[model samples]
Target: MLKRHHKTEALILKASPYGEGHTIVTALTSGGAQLKAMAYGSRKLTSRIGGHLSPLTRVELALYKSRDMDIIKQAQNLESFLELKNSLSRMTKAFFVMELIEGFSNTGVGNRPLFDLSLMSLRGLQSSSNRDIEDLTVSCFQLNLLKVTGFMPELYTCVECRSSLNSNNYNFIIDIGGLCCTKCLSGHPGRAINISSKSVEILRQFDKGGTLFSELPLGSTVELRRLLDSSTGFWLDREIRSRRFMEHMNSRDIREPMSAIDMESV
Candidate 1:
């Protein structure tokens, strides 16, 4: 009997050129599994899948089971977030978000919450007001991703003694997954990142599902960024390339002049 496989709708998370004229596409299916397949002749100018299979494009695809790799028979475009492509900042942020998802997600894991969060993050990136909002969205996504994946850090209490955290300064142990009160900090050799009260409050808001892209307190944003970056870096065991790109953009933001009107308004 011939083997059988079912078709599914997926969003292309990453894609790269393969062999001579083909392309390898990695996507997150609507069913919440990562799917990898090859789109033959995709590099050719006349290929129908040329523009449709690019990263971040939602597509409906037909797949056939094969011993080595799955075969992509047909592809139809569902939703193309064109705005992300139009602006460099938006594009970079979106790519970074996708990279995080791809890096953390498993091939056959069916996580509906993470899947929904990814889509929501993409939509926020597409329509974000400015770079600040984009940064906050990314931070929020990172926090939520860790939460859904069962890696959410114990931020409210000390990771060591389980005591309530009321300290002005915190020692965040990435491997242990949250703040270590001063007492705990002294015992461990983990890298520590400071956390301010305002930052802790902001994290609490995120834990409570506050609005994405809201006006963030600058201090809070900075602290949250540091916490997430440090935590993710330690847990993932390597630097994420997209994060370096984000840092580059942030540095540029620092050099840009702020309008008097903006300052007065804030």
Candidate 2:
């Protein structure tokens, strides 16, 4: 028995060619569940759904439930992030963010905070000045993702003894999802990353949503990159290819400074 479903709003995260003239669209519905559907003839030049099915485009799609895959009958674009698509850096960052959402968000789960954070991250990337700001935006998104997924690290206290963290530098254990003071670090065998006091302060700010990318310091930025990488990698148990690309992009940006005009533009 086949079930016919009407239209629903969705944000396209990934779309790839399925067959000769069709495409497979993977989207995150407003209800916070992942939806995969086949768009017939979407790859053709004359196809009306050509531009509307691109990643990050919000759309209303009509789908029919099939045994293995859902079939998309029609799609109408709700919002196209034109600004993000126009710039190469912005596009790459946006894709990375989408990849994170696609990889972490579970099917049939309703997480409004994750959805809202993803949308905000996209908008931030679109308007961000340089790679620095872009990295901060992604870092923030990753932190929020962990929080929404119920894996937020215990920053204010030791993961083992549950003692309040002081001004001393600590070793962050990715597997434990928090910090380990000098005593705990000696006892545990997990990989440890050094975190400075300033970095901890910045992380606290991130948790509170006080100041964002522009207000973050260089050291804090570096610490955040390390923390997010190790933490997410440990929990996910695999490397995210998009994150590698983002690292490459960040390195490239560091090799060249933005022009005075470019800096002024942001």
Candidate 3:
């Protein structure tokens, strides 16, 4: 028998007006399940749970399990991630993370790693101020997200022939979901994107949690971003809406110069 009333910790992914004074919230529960609940009267100014239910907030929620949907009975915020809210650039990236998570997650399917990665990525966006670091944060999150969700790209071998990619001459095919060796690239024409040897190394490092964006050159960062963007889009079947806004912000804002290491030629 399922409990009628229950409580769980959740990261609010999206919140939107439902009716006059109610809100429909989509959240990722700590137990690694996606949840959509109705927050009655939350749109009212005096409602107890109104402010606590905003998107990207981490909150503890008490819910009533109705037949149609869960109802949020009470709430308490756990982490507001205030620093991210202060910077437009970081906040946009944070939204992009949330959007990507939504694309990959399914309701009632428990994926604890996905929930943890989402929290860690948001916290990373909160603390970093550098544009390059922010870019890496999102990029790494995308890579890790793909790994946790079972879409990890094949970096070490040819997806076509299963031959060793020891020579480092490879092309990443988005539709095939992995690398195709140079020898096999001709058979699958048009979709293969040339991947450099260094980029391959960086991706391998990312897979094993061995590298950081700061340790690599800016050019590599840019390269990885393009690769991941295409990869993620192929999986989601639609572009992340927040990405365009984030790129526009990047182009318009002036920030500190890249550090000496990042400026090194790739």
Candidate 4:
């Protein structure tokens, strides 16, 4: 018999006290899998691994398989995201984004694109110069996360009718998972998210991996934010808890909570 040693690059998503002197750490490994590992003695004052295991710190780890959970044998800090930690708003946004990633992800399955996106998004949030840019970064991250995870809303046409929209204003139906035409909305009872053509055009660019922060259209942030938030919650089956905290930090109002059917659909 041999001990299983798994080595990976991981982002520490969360950590909680466990046992007398250990911590239960939730990490997103480089392969894009969520792993819960026990870092024994991490709570001790002299522990070396404790410093490297802080939330949002990227590190390389050697994990030994245990009966119920993995045990960390080695940890090397990769990126600490120090700037994000300096601001409550930024860090809360980081948590919100990571929470979304964790919600969509499953254990033991790898999604490289998503892993890279999450890392890049966190760095963007940390290094951003101001709140507006930070907001844009989070929005971009949400939109892109949905894209990578196969939950992207269809913006090109109506989800219900599958018809190309040629109007300056379109309705975003979270229940249907994308834009809806006036014709289709007549048959649908859910609240239709009104979006400008400019917003839709910019979002198309966003989906193509365009500039995230400095390029965001003025006055469209709220609309875009609500759209992504609504659709994401709709698909995920519940409102993301960190969203409220992030919005509070930003002083932005959340226009719509989850709709009745939106709650039922997920």
Best by lDDT: 3
Model 1, 134-166: lDDT tens digits are: 888889998998888788998888988999776
**Which whole-number lDDT from 0 to 100 does residue 159 have in model 1?**
86
Residue 34 CA error for candidate 2 (Å)?
A: 1.2
lDDT of 2 by residue, 1-266 (tens): 44478678888998989879999999988777788889989888888876689888989888888778888888899888898887757776787788878987877687777777878889888888877787788888888888887889988889999887667776788888888777788777657788888777777778888668476677778878888877777777787767665565556654354467533332
lDDT of 1 at 169: 77
- The per-model lDDT (C-alpha) reads 0.80, 0.80, 0.87, 0.83
Indicate whether candidate 3 or candidate 4 has the larger TM-score: 3
lDDT of 4 by residue, 1-266 (tens): 77599798999887888989899988888888888999999889998888899888999998999889999988999998888877766877898988888787778888888899999999888888887888889889889988988888888878887888867778887776788878888887768878888788778888888886475567788888888888788878998988876666566433345356533332
Q: Give the TM-score of candidate 2.
A: 0.88
Per-prediction count of colliding residue pairs?
0, 0, 0, 0
Model 2 has a clash total of 0
Clashing pairs in 1: none
Q: Using lDDT as the measure, what is the rank order of every candidate, best first?
A: 3, 4, 1, 2
Q: Which lDDT value does model 2 have at 263?
A: 35
How well does model 3 score by local distance difference test? Answer: 0.87
Q: What TM-score would candidate 4 get against the native? A: 0.88
TM-score of each: 0.89, 0.88, 0.92, 0.88
Best prediction by TM-score: 3
lDDT of 4 at 8: 89
Candidate 4 error regions (>4 Å)? 1-3, 213-218, 252-266
lDDT of 4: 0.83
